[model samples]
Target: MTSTPAFPPLKTYLTIIACALLLGGCSSGDEPASEPPRVALVEPLQPAEPQPEALRLSGVVQSVTTTQLSFEVAGRIERILIDEGTRIRRGQPLAELDRVDYQLQLSEAEARLRQLQADLARKRTLLAEGILAPAAIEALEANTVAARVARDSARRDLERSTLSAPFDGVVARRLVEPNMVVAVGTPVFEMQDNRHIEVSVDLPEIAALSIPLGPELKAEGQLVIADVSLPLRYKEHSTQPREGARTYRLVLQGEPPEDYNLLPGMAMRVSVQRPPRPQASQDQFRLPLSALQADSDGGHYIWQAADGRARRLAVELQEVEGDQALIRGDGLQAQLPIIVAGGSKLHEEQPIKVQERN
Candidate 1:
C-alpha cells in the first residue's frame, strides 16, 4: 500500500522531448525564422614553403670610385686623346699642351749651363796659375751649379705639357677638347673606375642593424642583373636622423657584369630575410583571414564541423600576414575540419554544412 502512487507515463515525457528537438533542429528552406545563410567552407591554409635561402633588396648601382682628371700646366690643349666614355690606361696620355714655350726655356737654361761650365774650367786653371783668388774660383763653381738647377726645372715644365691618366678608368665626361684653353689644375675629364661596382640601399635603422656584414643578399624574381648572384661585403656605415627617426646607410660590392653594360645609377630591388625564431617555427595550422571568429568575452575561436555537426574551438592567433593568419589552439590541424568560408555568419556550437570555398 505504501509506494503505489502513480507517476506520469514514460511515453508522454518521451513525446514532449521529441517535439522540442523538432523545433530546434536546423531548417532547410523557408522556415524563415530558423533558416541560415549558405557560407563558404575553407580548408586550412599553410604558409608558403621555404625555397633556397635567398634575400632580396632594393638598391641603385653606381661606380666603385670617381676621380677628376686635370692638367699640371696651364696651356691650350693641343690634342684630345679621348672623348666621353672612352676607356684609358694608367699613365696613358689623355691630352697634350703646346710645348714650344717650355722647350725654348729649356734651351736657354742649357746654353747658360754650357757657358758656366766653360767659365768654371777657366777659373780653376787661372786659380792654379795664381792669377785668380780661391774665393772667386769657388764663386764661379756656385754659378755653374745654379745654371744646371734651372735646366732641370725647365725639363719638368716640358714634361707637364703631356696630360696623363693617373689611374686606369673610363673618361666619363670630357670638359675640354682639342685646342681648348685650360688653366693649370683645370679638370679636363671626369673619370670613373668601371671595373668594380657597388649596390647601395636605404633601410630603416632597426632593419639595417639586424643585417650582418657578409650575409648573401640575393636578387630574386626580376632584377636588372639577371641570374648572376654575388656575395656581399659590407662597405660603408652612416647614421642620420630624420623626423626624429634614425636610419643607417649600407653598401655592398660586386664585379660588373661581363657585358660591362652595367651603368651607374641603375636601380634594383632587394629583400632581406628575418632569421627564424625559436618559437616561430612550431607545427601549427594557419587559415585565411576570413576564418577567425570572436566571442562576447573578446576571445578568438573558429567553428569546427564534424560528421555534419559543429563544435566551437578556442583558438589563438599568433600573427597575421596579408590574407592569411597563423593560429594555434586545441585541435587545429588538417585532420580536424573547420569552416573558413562561413566564419563571419556562424554562432558557437551551431550546426554547420561544410562546403568548399567559392
Candidate 2:
C-alpha cells in the first residue's frame, strides 16, 4: 500500500480510462467532414442555323368570298343536284323544290288571261264601232292588264322554285336533303370561292405597323403547308383589332399554285419577311423551348455549357414556332451546346457532367 501511494481500486481505474476514451471519440466525431458535390448531367447546345431575320406566323386558309344560299320561297325540296365539295358554275342548277303547285297556279293564271283578252278585244271593237260606251271599254282594258300581271307573277314564282348558283364556287355545305320541307329564306347551301383564297394572319399591333400592307406593297409572303410553299400577295390589313386580342388581321390574297389543291379551313404556316433594315442583324438561332427560362423582370435567359460548366446568358426571345423558340442574343454561336433540360435549377458556372442528350 505504501509503495502504490494509496491509488484507486482497479475497477475505478478501468472505468475512468473507459470514460476518457469515450470522450475523445465523441470530440473527433464532432469535427466537420468533406463531401463531394452532386454533378448535374449536361449536353452541348445545338443552336439552330442563323438565317435572315424574319417573323413566321400561323394562319388559316379561308375563302375570300363565301355565301350562304337560301331558298327565296318556301317549299318541299324535290331534288339536290350538287353535293358538298362539288364544283359549280354560275347559273348551275343546284337544287329543286316541288313545283306542281306553282305549275297549276301558272296554268290557271294563263287561262284567265285568255278570257280577259277576248273580252277586251270584243269591247274595243264595239267601242270603235260606237256600239259600246268608252267607259265600258276602259273597264275591259283594265281587266286585261290585271290578268297579264297575274300570269307573269305566277310564272316568276315557278322559276324561283328551282335553286341556281349565283356565282362560280365550290359547295362547302349541304344543309338539306331531298324532300325536306324548308321555310322561306332557309339556308340550303354554303358556297365558297376557293380559287381565290385568302390567308388571314393575326399580328400584334406593334408588328402590324411594321409590315406594309395592301396590293401596292405586295409584301413577300408564302403560305407553307406540309413543306409546300406557295407565293402570296398582300391584299389588305384590318384597321381595327380583333375581338379578345390586341392584334390586327393581315390578309394575303393569292390563288393556289398550279395543280396544288387547297381547301378552306386547312391550316398553314405563314411567313412574312420584311426588308431587313441596315441596322438589324440577320443573326438568329432556334432552340428547344425548354432551354429558355423567364426572369422576374419579364426577360428571358438561357443556360449554355462553357468549359464543363453551366453558363447563364440573357437572350431576346423573338418568337416561338412549334416546339422551337427563336432567339437572338449577343455572341451566340451555332453548334454551341446549351442545356435543354434541368436548367431551371442550375446556378451560373455550376459544375456539370457532360452526357449525350436523351
Candidate 3:
C-alpha cells in the first residue's frame, strides 16, 4: 500500500543529519594546509677590508752548506776517527788512509831527488873545472828540476791520504769503513754546516709574482720542534719554476735558538705577508662558509634575503680561512642579509623568515 513512508522520529532525523554534516566537515578538513615559510639564519654581508694577505706554507729545514767529502788520493782506509753525526772543526782530521804506500812513494821520491841533487852538484863542479860542457850542465839542471817536482807531488799525495774537514760542520754520513779501499774522488763523508740553517718553501708562481720588490716582503718562521718564532731574512729564491711544478723555491735564513738544536730535515712553518690587491679590495666580501652553495655544474652561489624571500646570487669563491670564506660578486653589497644556515634547502625566490645572527 502507498501508505505513508515509515519516517524516523524527528529527533532521530536531526541526529542523522548532524552526523552527516560532521563527516562532511572532517572530509573538507583532510586537505593539506599551506606550510609556513622556512626560517633561515642570516647575517649581514661584511666587506673585506684591505689587509695584508698572510700566506702560510710548510717548509723544510736545510743546511746552507752541504758538501760531499772525498779523498784526493786513492788508498785503503786505515783509521776513521769520527763517525756519523760527529761535530768537527775546520781542518780537523777526520780519517786516515793506509799511509804505508804513500810514505814509501815519498821516500823513493826523496831519494831520487837527493841523487839528482848530488848529480847536479857534481856536474856543476865539473862545469866549473871545465870538465862538463854547458849543454850537459843545463841538461843535468833540468833533470834536477823534474825530480824536485816529482818529490813535491809525492809529498802532496801523502798529505792528501788523510781526510780533513774543509769547514766546521757535522758529519751527516760516513760511506767507507776501516780497511775499505776507496778510489780518488769517491765520496767518503757527507758534511753539512748546521750553524747556518736555512728554510726552504715552495711558493706558487702567482704568489711569488705578487710579492713587492725591494725588501717589502716580510716573513717569519716557527720551528715545529719549538714554540719560538724567529724573524727570517730572505736568503735566495730559485729564478725558475721547480721541476714539473708551477712553484718557485723560496729560501730563508734565520738564527736558531740557543737552547734548541735546529738540524737539517726538521720542519718549519713560514708565514709571508703579501700586500693587498687594489682591484680586489672593493668587490670582496667575507662570509661564513655555510653561506656558500654549489650548483650541479660546480659553480658557487649564495642566497640573499630581500623582501622576505631568498634570492640566489652567483659568486666567485676567492679564498677560505678557517670558517669564513672570501667571495666576490657583481651585485653583492655590504649590510645585505645573507642566508647562511638554511640555504641548502631553499629554492630561488622561496619565501624565508630570517633570524638575525648576532
The Cα error of candidate 3 at residue 161, in Å, is 0.7
For candidate 2, the 10 contiguous residues with the lowest summed lDDT are 34-43
Candidate 2 per-residue lDDT, tens place, 57-169, comes to: 88888898899998888899999998899989999999999999999999999999999998888888888899988888777788889999999999998999999999888
Worst 10 residues of 1 by lDDT: 45-54
RMSD of each: 13.9, 15.8, 13.9
Candidate 1 per-residue lDDT, tens place, 1-358, comes to: 6788888999999999998877766543445465454444757445433323335567777789888888888888889888888878889898889889999999999999999999898888999999988998787788889999999999999999998888887889888778888898898889998777777777676676555545444332124656554444566656664455565556767776565466788776655555544345456666777878877898888877766656678888777766777788866556566677667766655655668665
lDDT of each: 0.73, 0.80, 0.88
lDDT of 3 by residue, 1-358 (tens): 5878787789998999999998998988677676568898999999987667778888998898989999999989999999899889999999999999989999999999999899888888989999888898787788889889999999999999989999998999998889998998999999998777899999888778887523556888998877978887787788899899999888888887777778888899999888876645678999999999998898999999999888999999998877899999889999989999967899987878989987
**TM-score of candidate 1 versus the correct structure, residues matched by position:** 0.58
Sort by TM-score, best first: what order? 3, 2, 1
Measured with C-alpha atoms, the lDDT of residue 53 in candidate 3 is 78
Candidate 1 vs candidate 3: which has greater TM-score?
3
TM-score each candidate: 0.58, 0.60, 0.61
Candidate scoring better on lDDT of 1 and 3: 3
What is the alpha-carbon lDDT for the whole of candidate 3? Answer: 0.88
